[model samples]
Target: MTDQELQTLVEKVSQESFRQPFCHNARFNQRLKTTGGRYHLQSHDLDFNRLVFEKYGTAELIKVIKHELCHYHLHLAGRGYQHKDLEFKQLLKKTGGSRFAPLLAPVVFQVYQCQQCQKMVKRRRKIDTKKYVCGGCQGKLKFLKTIEA
Candidate 1:
């Protein structure tokens, strides 16, 4: 969904779930990696990871919005909004918000093969064949990159 649509959804969930109006902006942030969403105390704005919707769908998105709204509302009301706070925990439970961000897809790893021994090696980082040798026979490794995932 577009950022405008996301903003509307956040505002709607805020009102429905928290009984509070989210006056600040809420937008999809492509740069957000692991977190489902974030509430900025300085601006009172909410930034959600677009991947959350893409990977988990609307239901998951709503949960994330609710989670962020808890932070937004509690902080605005001058109550404890941190994760460890009792008020935050109670509000999150009342709203059925996710306690933690959803897990992201595992990163694909590159695989290399030794042509001589036909041994395979897996690595998250790229390896220089010139500097690295195969473990099996100390044979030279060649790039046979394939995603482990």
Candidate 2:
């Protein structure tokens, strides 16, 4: 969904779930990694990872919205908005927000195998087999299939 749609959704969820209106901005931040959403303390703006909706669908996105809304509403009211606080925990549980985001797929890594010792190696970037040899036996290394960790 677009940023406009996300803003509307955050506003709607804030009203419906928290009984408070979200006055600040809400937008998708492509730079966000791992976390499903973030609530800026100073700006009161909410940022959601677009990949959440793309991978997990709208239901999960709504949960993430609720999670961020918990932070937004609590922080605005000057209550204990931190995750460690009782108020935050109670509100989050009451709102049915996710305590933790679901893990995304592991990163894929390039695999290499030693021709002599048959030792396996994984690297984030492609390495030249001609230059790099197996550490075990100084044997020739062959590029293997890439696999996810």
Candidate 3:
């Protein structure tokens, strides 16, 4: 969603869930790598990871928004807002917010192909080309490429 759409969504969510109007901006931030979302105390704005929504879709995005809204509303009301606070935990549970961001799977697979038989093989860990041979024909196995999950 665009920044304007995100802003509207934040306002809507605040009104429906918290019974408060969010008079601040909400925007997609491409530079956000790990976190799902962030709430700026000084600006009172919400910044969301664009990749989270793009990769995981709306349901995941909503959960992330709820997580950030917890920070937004609590900080604005002068309540306990940090992740470790009891109030924050209670509010997060009540609002069904995600406790931690979901991580992508690891990239450890290496793909190989037998040069003579052209058979494909996928290995979790890399193999020594000089020591390993194709299972089917005992032919030479050539490294094709590595894939990351």
Candidate 4:
């Protein structure tokens, strides 16, 4: 969904689940890697990882929204909003927000193959084949292709 849609959804979730309004911004952050969503303490804005919606669907995204909203509302109300706070934990559990972000799909990365034994190697970044030999057989490695996992 678009950023506008995300903002609306966050607002809706805040109202429905927390009985509060989310006045700040909420948008999809493509740069967010591991977390499902982030709540900016300074701006009171929320950032959601698009991958959560893409891979897990809207239901999961809503849960993440709820999670971030817990932080948003509590922090704005001058209560504890941090993850370690009792209020945060209670609000999160009450709203059924996900306690942890779901594991995203593994990253897409380059693959290399040892020429001698045909063993495979996976790496997030490209490695110079001449410099890094195969661990098992010390065979020269060649670029196979990039694989999306």
Candidate 5:
């Protein structure tokens, strides 16, 4: 969805779930690599990872929104908003927000093995066996296979 749509949804969720209007901006942040969402303490803005919706769908995305809202609302009220705080934990459980983001599988990569020591190496980009040697035994490295995981 577009940033405008996300902003509208965030605002709606904030009102319905928290009984508070989210006056700040809410948008998808492509830079969010691991976390599902983030609530800015200074700006009161909400940032969501687009990958959450793309990979897990709307239900999971709503949970993430609620999670961020917990942070947003709690921080604004000058209450305990951190994840470790009792008030934060209680609000999260009450709101049915996800305690942790769903684990995303690591990207597949090419694997190499040392011909002498059989030491394995994995890399996101393919490395030339002619130029690179194994660090373990200073042995020649050979392309093993691609690991899909």
Candidate 6:
């Protein structure tokens, strides 16, 4: 959905679920890499990751919206709005908001093997084969392949 649509949806969710109006802006933030949504404490604006909708669809997006709205409402009310607070936890549970964001990106691992002992290894980032050696055999390492998880 577009940013305008997201704003309206946030407003609708806030009113329906929390009995409060969302007066601040709500938009899809492509820069959000790991989070489902973010609520700015100062601006009271809500930013949602487009990846959530792209990967999990509208239902998941709505759940994330509800989650951020919980933060928005609770913070504006001058109550405990942090994740560790009892009020935030209660509001989140009462609204059926998601406690955690679903994993949105796959992790890539670079596979390497020891030239002498044939031992295999995996790393999240690429490493210089010339600089690093096999731990088990202390032999030169060679790049094998990359895998995603």
Which candidate leads the pack in TM-score? Answer: 6
lDDT of 6 by residue, 13-128 (tens): 88999998899999988899999999998899999999999999989999999899989988998999999999999999999899999999888999999999998999999999
Error of 2 at 3 (Å): 0.7
Cα lDDT computed for each candidate against the true fold = 0.91, 0.91, 0.88, 0.92, 0.91, 0.92
Candidate 1 lDDT tens digits, 45-91: 99999999999999999999999999999999999999999999999
* Residue lDDT tens for model 5, 67-103: 9999998898999999999999999999898999876
In model 5, the worst 10-residue window by lDDT is: 101-110
TM-score against truth, every candidate: 0.73, 0.74, 0.70, 0.72, 0.74, 0.89
Clashing pairs in 3: none
For candidate 4, write residues 56-147 as lDDT tens digits.
99999999999999888888889999999999999899999999999986778899999999999999999998799999999999998998
Off by over 4 Å in 1: 107-149
Q: How accurate is candidate 5 locally (lDDT)?
A: 0.91
- Can you tell me which runs of candidate 4 are displaced by over 4 Å? 107-149
Compared with the true structure, the alpha-carbon lDDT of candidate 6 equals 0.92
Give candidate 6's error at residue 38 in angstroms: 1.3
Q: What clash count goes with each model? A: 0, 0, 0, 0, 0, 0
For model 4, the local distance difference test gives 0.92
Candidate 2, residues 98-120, lDDT tens digits: the string is: 99887755788999999999999
Candidate 3 per-residue lDDT over residues 1-149, each given as its tens digit: 88888888878887887788888889998888878888898999989988877889888888888889999999999999999999999999998889997663455789999998999999999999899999889999999998886
Candidate 2 deviant stretches above 4 angstroms: 105-146
